[model samples]
Target: MIKNFTVFKRKLSHVCNLKPYKDTKWLMPNGNPTGLFVYNCVADQKVPVILSDPHIATWYSCGPTVYDSAHIGHASCYVKLDIVQRILKSFFNIKLVTAMGVTDIDDKIIKRGKETNTNFKSIAQQYEYEFWLDMANLNVEKPSIIARVSDHILSIEQFIKKIIDSDMAYVTPDGSVYFNTAKFPSYGKLQKMQDCGEPLSVLKRNKMDFALWKGPKPGEPSWPVSWGEGRPGWHIECSAMVSKLFGSQLDFHAGGVDLQFPHHENEEAQSCAFHNTLQWANYWIHVGHLSVKGDSKMSKSLKNTISIPELLDKYSADTFRMACLMSNYRYPMEYSDQMMQTAEETLKKFKFFLKDVYVYVNNNALQNGVYKDKLLDDLQNVEYQNLKFLKSDFDTASCINNLLSLMSNTNNIIKEKNGEYYPVPIILIADYVTTVLMKFGVTLKENTEDSVSNSIIDTLVDFRHTVRLNALTRKDKELLNACDIVRDKMKMIEVQINDSNKTASWVFTK
Candidate 1:
C-alpha cells in the first residue's frame, strides 16, 4: 500500500532533559537559582506539554497596555524574551510561534480615556499604533499574533461561560464574575505567596481571589455578556486570549517578574478552572524588572521612565540592545547614561576589530595559515559558552562576557599577525564576528553616510602617498596635481565625519 516508504521515513530527535539543576553562573555567581513552574493536568495527572515531536512551540507574552507609550522597562521585558525565542530556535533547534496580547480594555485604559476626553476605542488605537512604531524603531520583532481584547469579546465570553459552568466561577450581586479561590488550591504557588505577606485586597472572600469580569461603569469600555454590560478584568484578558488562541494548555507563558503575582496567578486560576485541570502552561518564564538610577524601579507614573523612541533618537538601537544584554535577563539592570556611553565605546572597539579582520583577510599579499584555525576555534567556543550560559536559564550577562572574551582574543590574534597575511580567511573571521554581534542586535556597520565617506577618505590618504612618491621620483606634474585634488577631498570628508560624530554625541548626551 505504501509505495515510496523512504519518503515517509521519520528522523530521530533528541529529547530535552527536564531534570532541575543548580545554575552556579547566576547574576551574583551564587544566588538562589530561579525555578520553573509546570502545570499538571488534574484529569490525566500528567503535564500537558505537546508530545515530543515536530511542531511549532508556542510562547505567549503579556504585552503592554496601550494607555501609554512603551518605555525602556517595557522594552527590557520584550528584549529578554526575544533572546529566549532566538536561543530556542538557534541552540535547541526548535520551531517557535510567539504571540502578544494588548490590553485594550482595562481600568487604566478607561481612566486614560477620561483624562484625554477621547472614546476608549480611539484612545486604544492611537496608542497601539504608536506602540508599534516604537517597537519598529527598536527593531523588536512582531509576535506571530497581536490579539487585542476588543477584537475577541465573544471568545472572552465563551471562556467565562466554560468556567462558570464548571462551578469554578460565580457572578456577584453587581454582575461581576469572580473566580472562587478556594476552588483552586494551587492559586498562590507561582510566586510562593505563603512566604510573602498576605495579599492586600479585602474585596474577595479569599485574599488571593481576583476578578474575572468587572461590571459595567459609566464612561468605560463595555461588552454585552451573559452577566451584564461589562468588560474583562486585567488578568482575565490574558487567560481568555491564551485559552482561545493556544487552548487551555501552553508550552510557555512569559512576562516581567512583577506579573507573577496577581496577573499570572489569576490567569492560572481562570485557565485551570475552564479546563478542569491544574496546569495552564508547561513553563512560566518571568524576566526581571529594569531599574533606573541605582536600584529604583522605572515607572511612568513615578515619572522616572525613559521612552523607547526618545532613547533611540539619542543612541543607536544596537547600543541600546547591547546595554540591555550587559545584565542578566532575570536580574535588575540599573540604567544610566554612563552605561550607555560605555556600551557605545565597547561597540566601537568591536567594529574596529571587525574592520581590521576584514582588511587583513582581503589583503592579497597576506598568507592564510597562521591564525585561521585559532580564530575559528575561538569563535566556536564563544558559541558554545553562549549556549551553555543561556541554557542555564538565559544567563545573558555571562554569555556576553564570554563573547567579549572571544572578541578580545580574536583582536589579539589579529594584532600579532606580522607575517604574510591571508586575507580570505581573515575576512571569514570578520563575517563570523559580525554575525555573532547581530544575534544580540549590535551592528558594526557605521551609523551614517558621512562615516562611510570618511573611511573612503582614509583609503585615499594611501593613494595620495603613492601619488606623491611618483611625483617626486618622476617629476610628474600630473601626479602632483592629483595629490592636491585628493587633499581637498580628504578635508571635505574629514569635515563631514566630524559633524556627524558631533551630532551623534550631542544626541546621546541630551
Candidate 2:
C-alpha cells in the first residue's frame, strides 16, 4: 500500500529567506520569465496570484501518451515536476495532491496500434506498464492520481455536452466538435499568438480555434456521445480530467512549455467555459523542453531520442536523475554522454560521503553520549537552506548542488575532528539528506550489515591503493584488469545488499 504523509506536520516554519514577489516578475536571475499567463477568453491577460496558503497546493501534470517507450524528454518533465512537489511538501509542510493523466485515447495510440497490428487498448496497456517501470527505476513517486482518459469517457462526454449547451463549442458538417474561438474572444493569451510575427487567423478558424471533440475515423477509438461516435480532443482530455479530479478551480496546472499554445490554451477555454469561472488555475507552471546534442527539440522521427530504460540500464537511475537536476527546471537541458558521466561521478562522491558518515555515526554510537547542539544547528541550517531554495519556485538544481556542498563541508569537518563526539546530529543530517534524496528519486539504501559495508569500503580503498602501487611499479595491464574485476564484484555485492535491505525494511515497517 502507498503510504500517505499528508497528516504529518513539521514544527519548523515554512517561510523561505528570499523576498517574496509582490507583483508578476518577468525575468529571473537567469533571464527567464518566472511568471506565466493563462488565456481565459481568447485574449491572454496576465493574472497575478496570491500565495497565502503555504500548506496546501494541488498540481496537475500532463502525462505521457503511452503509445511508445518514454524518452529522456518525458523523464525530464517528470523529474522537474517531482522536484517541485517535493519542495512544496518539505518546505511548507504542505500536502500536495498531484495528478498525472495518461493519454490512453490519443490518435497516436490508434495509429501506432494499427501499425503494430495490435489492439489499441492492448497497446496502451503495454506502454503504460512500461512507463510505470521506467518511473519506478528512476525512483519517481507515483502521482496522487494516475487517471486514464479511457476510464473517464463519461466525464469527457458530459463536459463536451456542457460546452455545446453553453454554445462555446459547435459541431462541424462532420461529427467533429470544435470550440468556437469567436465565442471566447480572449483566446491566444497564454502563448501570445497575436503578438507572434504570423497572423493569428492562419492557424485556425479565428485567432484561437481548436478541436474539442474529434469525429471518429474508421478503426479509431470512439464513444457514443451527443455528437455521433467521436473521441475527445487532446485539450479536452486534460480539461475534463482536471475538472473531474480537482474541481473547476485548481491550485496549479503544469506541463511542458511546448504545450502552452493550442493545448493548454484550449484547455483553459474549455474548463472556464464549462465551470463559468475565471480562475481556471491559481498558478500555471511549465517546464522547459529537453534537448539532444544542444538542440531544443527531440523527436522520435529524427531517431535522436534517448529512452529512459536504455539510459537507466547504461548508467544507474541515480546518475540519470542527477543529470536532470544539473539543469534548472525552467531551462532546457542538453543531454550527452559527457553529462551522464559527470552525473555518475557526482553520485559516486555523494554515496561515498554518505557511507563515511553512516560508518562514523554507527561507530560513535558504540560510545554513547548526548547529541551535540552545535552540529544539530549546522545540520538544521543546511536543511533550512534546502527548503528555502526549493520553496523559491522549486529551484531543486540549485538546492541539490548546495546540498552537495554541505556534504563536502560536513566531510571536512569530520576529517578535522573539530568537535567532541556528538554522532546523533550527524546521523540526523544524513537521515534528512537521505529522505530528501529519496523524494528526488535517488536510490539510497541504509547499510545494516557492518561486515558487508566494511568490506565494500575496504575493497574501494584497496583498489585505490592498487592503482598507486601499479603506477609506481608500471604494471598497467594488471591494475586495469584488477580494477574492472573489483568494480564488477562490488556492483554485484551492492545489488544483493540493497535487495536484502529492502526486504528487511519492508518487513520491519509492516
Candidate 3:
C-alpha cells in the first residue's frame, strides 16, 4: 500500500533517475514512455496526470453523505471512479493512495434523525454500513483511508482555527466561523467564477462566503472548538480530512460534477487559504450525473432513485457496471430499461464467446495454424487501442467497443477453421480479455453455492457428453431430444451448455 509515506519516499529516491518521456508528461515507474490525460475540471481542459515521485499518486474523493441507501446515480459515480482507480493501479502500475471522506455528520442526517426520532449517529452508521455493502457488491475497491467527520472533529476545528489565524476566516456573532471568500484572491479558481469583492454584511462577511463551523444546534452533534461548541460544515469536512491525510498538496481531488459549483469550489478555496498556496490539488476530476427519464438526475432527495439493492436484485453487479462502461465516464449516463437490456445482451455475448474459447482451448492441443500471424496482429492492435482509450481520460466506452470488435474478429477466424483454434493464441486472447474485463469490475464467473455444486456440474457435463455420443451412434432421435431437455433445464440454474459433435462443455452463466 502507498499509505506509508516513509516507504513511498524511500522507493521514490531510487526511481528519481527515471524521467518522463519528451513527448508526454506521464511515465511508468520503470521509465517506459506512457501517457494518461484527464480532463481537469479546474483547468477546463484535458491535462496530463504526471506522478511527482515517478510512481505514487495521492487522491482524495468525496464520499456519500450516509443518510440513506445509495442509489444508481451514486453507483455510477463510484463504479466509474473505481474503474479509473483500477486502471491506474493495475494497468499503469501507479501506486495510488486514495482517501475518501464519509459525510456522516451532515444536515441530512440530522433532519432524518429528527423525523424518525432516532439518534443521528445510529442513522449515519446504518447507512454507512449499507453504503460499503453496496460498494462491495458493485466491486468498488476500498480506499486507502476512510475518513469520517465524526472521527476527526478535533482536526476539523484545528483546521478552521488555522484559517482564522491566517485572517482569511472570521468568527460570527453567533459563535460560528465562516470562510471570508473576499479575502482569498483566487477564491473561485475551481469554478472559474470571479469574486464579487462585496463588503461585509450584518449576517455574513460576504454573500459568497460559506460557513466553516456552524454553532451548536439543539439535538444535533457538536464538538468543542476554540471559538465555541460547533459542528464542521459540509465543505470544510472534506478539506480538513484531506489536508490531514495528504498534507499540503495532493495529486487529484474528485467528486460528482454537481459539486463543481459551490461544494468543490468552497473546498478548494479554504484548502488553498489554509495552506497558503495557490494550488492545493493538482487535478480536479468530476464525474457526470446519472439521469433517468425526463432528464431528471437520479437522487435520493428527488425520490427518483433505484436503490443499489433494488437494482442489484433485477440485474447482476456486472450488468450495472457494464452499463456504466458503455458510456463515457465524463458524461451523463442514462439509466433506462433499454440501457440495461443492452448491457445484459452485450455481457451475454462476451460470456458466450469466452466460454466457447475456453472449452476449445482446454480440449484441444496447441498447434501452429494458418492464421496465427493474423490473430496475433489483431490481438496487438486491440490491446494497443484498449490502452490508448483508457489512457485518454479513461474512455472505457471505446475500450469496450474495441473488445467487441476483437471478439467478433476472433470468433470469425476460429469459425473459418471449423472450431479448430490454435490453442496458444486463443488462450492468449482469452487471458487478455478477462484481465481487462476484471479490471473493469466485470466478473465472468457465476457464484456457485459450493464445491459440491461445481463437482456436480462437471459430472453432469461429462455424463451428458457420453449420453449424447451414445445417442448419435445408436441413431436414436428420442434420446437427442432428451439431451436437449436436460440442457434447457440447466439454463434455469444459470448454467450454459456448449455441445460439439463428440463432446460437450459447461460454464456458469452469471
Tell me each candidate's TM-score: 0.79, 0.76, 0.85
The candidate, 2 or 3, that scores higher on TM-score is: 3
Model 2 CA deviation exceeding 4 Å by range: 1-54, 195-204, 361-377, 417-425, 446-510
lDDT leader: 3
Backbone clash count, each prediction separately: 6, 7, 0
Q: Which residue pairs in candidate 1 collide?
A: 361-423, 366-421, 366-422, 367-420, 367-421, 367-422
On a 0 to 100 scale, what is the lDDT of residue 49 in model 2?
Answer: 25
Best by TM-score: 3
Give the alpha-carbon lDDT of every model: 0.67, 0.68, 0.82
| Cα lDDT of model 1 by residue, 1-510, tens digit | 223323322110112222221211000111111221122222111122332233457789999898888899988888778777776665566677888999888777788888989887888899999988887766678899998998888988889888888888888777688888887877666665533424745445665566788888776667899877688878888888888888856877889888877788778778878887756676677777888875568888688988887887778777877777777676677788898988776666566566456544544543445546766777677777766666566666787677667767765655553544445445665676676567665544455444345544555544556557667689898877876676556445422111111011111111
lDDT of 2 by residue, 375-408 (tens): 6777788778776666555667776787787777
- CA lDDT, candidate 1, residue 13: 10
Instruction: Tell me the TM-score of model 2.
Output: 0.76
Regions of candidate 1 where Cα sits further than 4 Å from its true position: 1-51, 194-203, 364-372, 420-425, 449-455, 460-510
Error of 1 at 32 (Å): 28
